[model samples]
Target: MTIIKNPVIPGMAPDPSIICVDERYYIATSTFHWTPGIQLFESKDLANWQLVGYALNNEEVNLRGTNTPAGIWAPHLSYDPQTKRFWLAYSHMVNMAGREFNADSYAIWATDIRGPWSEPIYFTSIGFDPALFHDEDGRHYLTILEWETREGYQAPGHIVLAEIDLPSGKLLSPWHRVTQGFTTRGCAEAPQIYKHQGAYFLLLASGGTGYAHGVEVGRAETIFGPYEAHPSGEPILTSSPRHLFSLGDPDAGHFEMVNPHSVMQKAGHGSLVHTHTDEWFMAHLMARPLEGQLLNPLGREASIQRMHWTEDNWLEMEDGSNLAKMTFKGLAGVPIDNEPNTDLFDSFQEPQYLLEFMTPYRQQHQSWVSTQKRQGFLRIYGGNSLFSQMNPAIMATRATSFTYEVETLLEFQPNHYSQTAGLGLYYDSNNWLYAHVTYSEEKRCPYLTLLQAKLGQRIEYVNTRVIVPEGNIQLKIGYDHGIANVYYRLEEQETWQILLQDLSVAYLSDEGVNGMPGEIGGFTGLFTFIGAVDAHQHQSYADFAYYKVTNHSPAS
Candidate 1:
């Protein structure tokens, strides 16, 4: 049997919705606050994944002012064999102020996986994390959480189901209240359904999204009502089964619940499928924190685990335990290559950027970022600063590893203090650490500076300033676990000089930078990218020769 690693898709690929169409496997994951929403990954053996495309690339919804952990929530993907169409259900979480979540859930269909998907058909605003299930008898059902806001009620919410008409986006029947949870581990959401044998199975994400996060299952003879909990009365799958502190707790970052022994945390929000060989597998969200740290700067990632049904018809891990494992015996005898989760390099030589690269809030503008401006360099015309959710000339890639280094060679001629360009780690507009080159009025020349944003507060490190010559400059950032160190050099062969060291930027993590208490810290993980700011009429341009990221051993 081949051994499949825990996290098949790393770096902020959370809330995975997996479907096996014919012999191919596809997963649609949540892209909170990132534009070109609903990232899709394709796999042949479920071991190696490729970013095929996204379901939402066009402007169906505006995300300009979307708050942290708010924009796009759980996205579900399914296929209706009767209609010969692919259906996608997702929520545009507009606001979560005061815990009254305001979300617009929608469904869209396309004949093929890579759309030309239809315009979003508004489904309901009842709650978020919507999923569509097509029964064998040509019936379409919707499952979602009925977010509870009552003072002494069930804390977070309950799983609810209803019959939905796809074409008109109308509900055919009243909602049926499903189980509050299969176990006492409350805070359930992201409900998905499946059928096996003669019973309908309801699967949910429970125990919150923290360390106690897990997947629980219940089965019913009918679509709704009278669903019986699993005989175990515990999560069918989890990373931390021994922790009992998360029961009935809706608060995020119960960092104390973190499982210190495992590299994977927050292992929940799962979707299941059967392979061609009749083997069972589930795709869920998992996080890989740096060693000895509970903060997950990479965010919740997509992980696959092998599963099986007992003789009594209840689902359990293939290894017969609820606790998640780092390595599982892969589909037996299925040979597959190990996929690397570490590094990348972009020389800006391509005519266009890859779909894996994404911008925040707004669509990419050619006037601001273009390859044609310079022959081999990516020319970025600075617009607004990184704090603006609107138009900022920043192109970013997912940071898959905690201990990695990202460096870029840039030639930026900033005419004003507002026109700066460089590279750094970004969680959102309100949270980031950027080391850049800007015009220093005091130095009377170009100088390198470091800027940081923690929970919407921006701080310019005046002591970190160093004047540099006006030519090609190489800037490097080292993220050794939680700490971020910034370095710069005149040339590739020159020794890197410290611009800033041990910045204690781990607070940029999902557990550390929550704008408000009690809610999730942040869903979108840390991203490494090159960005620029030009408040002065957007005239200045920075040409980046190349960008490189490499995984390295963390320093103590």
Candidate 2:
């Protein structure tokens, strides 16, 4: 028995799609509005995960200026042993603002996991959250969530299974809508099909994507027809411990949750996979707020839970409760240890961008970024302040927690007054902390200023002329939960000085002190950055000396 804690892969690691191939496990997750998208993580142990690479690095997958909850949606990974092929299914949830739920789904297949993955073969244009199942006899069938948009309907959602000739990527038969006003919660979607003991089981994420979120199950003698909901008739897994009015309704995917207890809201929509030794694990979403009091900036992070099966085939939490925690063991009982983990710190010894780096839209201009020059320095050319969700020069990584220190070395000599670069914490465009040195040409003097932007307001608390005889310096940011402080030093200064004080992260949080609406929810974490901004630049670049995360304080 091993005890892994809650949130196996912390901070906005949402829409987890896990697959086991030849003893190697791979997990793919959604990266909404953050470019260099679709991070892939690998693990030998089910409880520990490490980033392997990203699925989309082209500028086509926009992250800059992209809104919350709108980039990539649910991703599914499957392995077809016969062909030794890894097929990936995903959706680009474009234009979520008007609630234009119309999604563009696509499928990509790879022969080598390290991929030169085939260009996506567009799947159905009408839905999202798609999965594929390859049966024992070389038969391929597709399962996806078909939108139920008729207004007067009980729930505008249902799960459908269609047999498809994937080689041509077309449905072979009329899709079967296996769910309607029935057992389990109304928003029945994210369905996975599996066979055992001569029977097939259909697993679904019910209620909408919020408070009523739950994992539901059904079984049928056949893959397409006459399926019966699990006898329990309620969620097999849910977080309604105290049950509040907010946990009401229970939407289509979790549509039932009109209101819910704050304990664990938006807890469903997932895919389950069995370890080689037959242990069960599930990948689902959760959210954590910037302000302890409100779970805003609603980003969906992926959390894994353990499962045990009864002789009669009911799936349950290993200990019979869905309490969110970090540790769980594989059924085979391999040796386990709880080592403290870290996000990603780059010393740049490899002469390439670390896996932790991401751009706004993966803007294919390789000339824009590099790691080959200085062993630990990352060079990025500034281009745009922020563009549409489609593009921006900004680079960002996952926000691993509510509090953590992000420090980096920056060495840049600007050619013009417009080239100002440094490091700080960012929520979105409307709100962020900017701590950097701007060239003051009118005075031929450099100045260090702590500029804070709260939604509609921009406040500069510390604006002082700096004596930077040299061009290189170090920048550090300390976030005590949500309140923030900025620190920096000139070449002559021996120690870091606190440049700013008493800042509120809520301005950058879901509460929306800024122009943006706060995040909706799903336990996603925040992302930090160490880069340059060319808001108004004339061919100038910032060389990131190196960025590292340490237990040591940023101020020191």
Candidate 3:
């Protein structure tokens, strides 16, 4: 047997929904508040995964002014062998004010995974985390959380099921309220249905998406009926196995349930797959906190665990323990040789930016950002400031490791202070650190400065300004654990000068930032970006020669 390490897909890939078509396996993950949403990955050997493409490449959904952790949520991918088409269902979380959690769910289909997808068919605005289950008998069902806003109801809501027409996207039957949760850890959502041995299994993500997160199970003889909880009366998969009863808790951030013994936390929201070789494995979301801190700068990642069905038809971890492991056994005779593709170097030589690059709030288009404008450089026309959720001209990649360095050669000349372009460590519109070049009126020269936004408060490193000669400059950020060091060097200078050192960016994390009263601040992880801001007149633009990311840590 091969030893497969966890986190096959790292950094910001959460709420994984896995499906196996033929012998190939695909996993779809949520890309909240990020454009080109619903990231999909492909894997053949179950241990190695590759980014194929995104389901939402066009402006099928509007995310303008989207709040933190509120945009695309829990994208579920499914394949209908009968129709030979791929189906994707996701929710567009529009509002969280007053904890109403209003969202609209929709589904799209495509003959191919990467291609011209059909127009989205609106399903319902009742709740979020919508999933589609294509039954073996040609019937289809939609499972989603019926978000409860009543004062005296089950906290988040119940996992409801309804028959859905695939072509017309209409609900044929009224929703059936299934069990709230099979385990004591409540806050259940992300319901996925599977069939095995004449039974319909409902897999749920329970205890929220935090330290108390886990994957609970329930089975019913019919498609929608009274379901029986798992025999264990606990989550079959979780990072923390110790029991804690949180039935009525609506708060998703169960910080008190942190298990010190576990290296991986927030192991829930799983999607199971039965391979062609008759082996079973699950793709789920997990988080690795920074060393001893509860802060996860890398955010929720995708991890695979070995699983098996008992003689009684109940699913359990292959190791017989409910706790998720960092390393598990792979399929027999399958070799695990692929490593994580965390390191990236894009010189913008091609007509298009690398597919790994993603933007926030706005979709990537030739109007604002393109590589064809210049032969060897990516020219990005400045849009709005990072503070605005509407439009920000940023091209970023996920920070896959705690100890990594991002470097970019930027050629930008700013006439106004509002027209600045450089490298940054960004979490969202409200939390980020930028090292850019702008006009220095007093010195009468273009200089480099550091700006930070911590929980909506802007802080400028006024004393750490360095005057640089015009033209191309190399900007780099060396991130060690949770701290970041900014450096810059002129085109002619062989050595780099430090602009800011020992700046603790731990605040740019899910738990560090402030969000809605009872919810986690941010869901998307940290990203290193090459962006330009033109809040003045939107006439300024920046040219980036290359963007490079190097990971120092070993691939997980």
Candidate 4:
């Protein structure tokens, strides 16, 4: 039990899959297109996991035109002892641009966990969150959420089971709709199948990934069920202490919460692991909104809780209570200590930029920032408006652990008609907080001003012109609730000016603002966007001496 306060793994680190092989342990999480697709963490001890390497990189797993929140889905990781190879199954959500969410499922194999993985073996058109089970009878099965999109159907889909032929990547058994989730609420997803004592168990995640979200279970004598829901008739774990969050999508209400707590939010969707030391733990998603209000940005982070099973085959928390905690330390595989939580503070002292920076649709060219090009600074060639809900000249980091802070210093001159570059906070291309320097030839001058992406609309001229003086400058942003206040300095000797641009409504947090379903609106987290906009013919490149981001608050 690693009692990790709040998010153990942050940003879109949901639906965690943990596996123990020998004395080593591994954790794999879903990455929604911050290239270098699946993030894998290694640990000798459950409490301190180290980022060993990625499961898939852009070169290995291409997501060239993948849309925001649409590039990848919950990835399930498993090891086949017979094959002695690790298998990763994931959905490359290619159609998110059209908001279709119809993704292409893929399977990749590797002899070593840190791998030069085999070319992706195109798998069936099965729905997302595909899990593979290797049974004792030498049979392999694939279980998925068979998406039910017919009219009258609601959010939180259904579950399906099929026998998959590993060699050919085909579904040997006909897909069976196991649950419409009508009885379990709309959330019939992330299903994992296991066998113990001649009985098969199906572990599921439902309740829409919100406060009502939960980890559920059912059992069947056969792989394909005429299965029965747990006699308890409700989720095994949930966080909405208040009972306000519905367990299933609006319809399955018979087991609705008697009480709910608002403290933990968007908590559900899970996978389990029996550690090398024989301790059982479950990895699921959870969130903490800004100051316990709306604006949950640490989207579906990875959290672990301990669980126990009895000879009768019923599951419960080790302590007989279903409540999860902020942190818990369990038995160690090998004692592992960790370094203080830190992200890269990139100074171009190295030849290349750290892979942590990601662009909207395309990978920003290396020529765009290099050792030879602009001295020590990384220069973003100003290209497009930061307002488009699509690709913008933005590079951001995944918002991990709610309490961390981010700040950057930038220096640039805007010349082109629509060229604007600056430092600000961004959740996605469509929603962000920016203060840029743009030029207007009609006025025959350039100025540094504040801009923002609010309610899907780019609002400008809030304070039309605070003309930027011609010289090296610095821009800074401090964020708490996805909301931020802007500050700037003209020279090293000057004090920071509080640019009065309050980003209260920029992230689309309220009703009818910055998000699309579970994809956008729920909680995309906060990020620093250092972008260049090209509103005209000439390309504008903005030189940033060095961009520094710190979780340290200036007030501290």
Candidate 2 Cα errors over 4 Å, as ranges: 58-65, 181-184, 241-265, 289-292, 296-298, 322-326, 337-340, 373-375, 386-391, 415-417, 456-469, 507-524, 551-556
Best by TM-score: 3
**Highest-scoring model, lDDT:** 3
Backbone clash pairs in model 3 (N, Cα, C under 3 Å; residues 3+ apart or in different chains), count? 0
Residues 1-556 of candidate 2: C-alpha lDDT, one tens digit per residue: 6655556676667768888776667889877656656778887776667887767765444444455556677778888989889888888877654444777888888886667677778879767888888988898888887765566553445678988887678988988987643344565667888777778878787666655666777888888956787665666666543232222232322233423344345666667778887778877765554433544443556677888777887666778765443445554756545453754677666766667776544453556677765566777776554322443445566666555678877776665555667776666554566676667676575556656566536666544445454667788887766677777877777998877666667545434532233224222345576655565643667778678655332110
Better of 1 and 2 by lDDT: 1
Per-residue lDDT tens digits for candidate 1, residues 1-556, read: 8777767877879999998888889999988888788898988777778888888888887888788889989999999998889889999999887788989999989988988999999999988999999999888999998877878877677788999887788999999989744556788889999999989999989888887789989999999857889987889888887846355567655556677777778889989998877899999998877666667788888988889999989899988888787777776556786654546788889987656678888777687888899888989889788999888778888888768899999998876888899998888888898889998777667888889888889898887877776746899999887888889998644699988888788877787786455445787898888978899888999999988888784211
Reference-based lDDT, each prediction: 0.84, 0.65, 0.89, 0.65
The true-versus-predicted C-alpha distance at residue 212 of model 3, in Å, is 0.4
User: In terms of TM-score, which candidate is stronger, 3 or 4?
Assistant: 3
Model 4, span 102-144: residue lDDT tens: 8777788787788877777777664677888888888888888
Query: Candidate 2: TM-score?
Result: 0.88
Q: What is the alpha-carbon lDDT of model 1 when measured against the actual structure?
A: 0.84
Minimal lDDT window, size 10, model 2: 245-254
Clashes of 2: 60
